[model samples]
Target: MRPDSCLSQVIGMTFDASVCDMFCAWGAGATLVVPARRELHRIVDYIVDRELSHWNSVPSALAIVEGLGQLVS
Candidate 1:
C-alpha cells in the first residue's frame, strides 16, 4: 500500500504543493511520493493507475471516479 501524494492547492497557490512536499520529504528525507494534478480524471487516474488502496479527497473526486466506473466496493 502506497500513499500517493496529490499536489492540489487553492487556485493561486502554485508552488504550495512543492513546498509541502519539501517539508514532508525533509521530515523523512526521501522522495517516496510523487506529485499529482488536481483535475478530475487525472486525480482518479492516479488512484486507479497506481492501484492505491486508500485515498482522501474531495467529494467531486469520488463523484468523478464513480461516474467513470468505480471498480471498488
Candidate 2:
C-alpha cells in the first residue's frame, strides 16, 4: 500500500528517531502519543485499553506487557 494513501493511520509511540518515518511512511492522520509520565504500567494500560492498531518498539516494551499479563494472544 502506498504510504500516501494510508490516511488516518495512528502512530507515534516513542522517540527512537523513527517517529518521522512512522508518520511519513504511514501517511497522515497519525498522531504521536508521548505519555506524560514514563510509567510502564500506564503506557501498557493505554496500549491495551485503546487496542492501538500498530505497535513497534524495543523488546523491553513487549516484555513489560507480558510481565503485566496484558498480552492478548
Candidate 3:
C-alpha cells in the first residue's frame, strides 16, 4: 500500500492479525482507522466511507461481511 493508503483496524488487540494490521500500515506509512465497537456492525460502510485501502482480520469477521453481502467482488 502507498503512504496515503488508509488501513482498517478491525481486529482486536489480542489477535495476531491486529499486529500485522498495525505494523503493515505503519511500515507503509499508511493511516490506520480504528472504529469503535458500535461502528463494527457496519464495518463495510466504515471501510468504504473512510476509504480504507487495506484490511487484516480473522476469517470469521470476513464471513460476517460476506454474509452481509457487502464484500466487494
Best by TM-score: 3
Each model's lDDT comes to 0.47, 0.50, 0.83
**Candidate 2 residues 9-33, lDDT tens each?**
2234455545553565446545434
Ranking by lDDT: 3, 2, 1
Please, what is the TM-score per model?
A: 0.38, 0.48, 0.81
Tell me the tens digit of each residue's lDDT in model 3 across 1-72.
779989888778876667887888899999998888888888788878888887777768888889999888
Candidate 1 Cα errors over 4 Å, as ranges = 1-22, 30-45, 48-56
Candidate 1: tens digits of C-alpha lDDT, residues 33-63: 3534443345656656655443444456667
lDDT score, candidate 2, position 50: 54
* Model 3 global lDDT (CA atoms, 0 to 1): 0.83
Candidate 3 — which residues are off by over 4 angstroms?
71-73
For each candidate in turn, give its C-alpha RMSD to the true structure in angstroms.
Answer: 5.6, 5.4, 1.8
lDDT, candidate 2, at 54: 52
Q: Which window of 10 residues has the lowest lDDT sum in candidate 1?
A: 1-10
The lowest-lDDT stretch of 10 consecutive residues in candidate 3 is 9-18
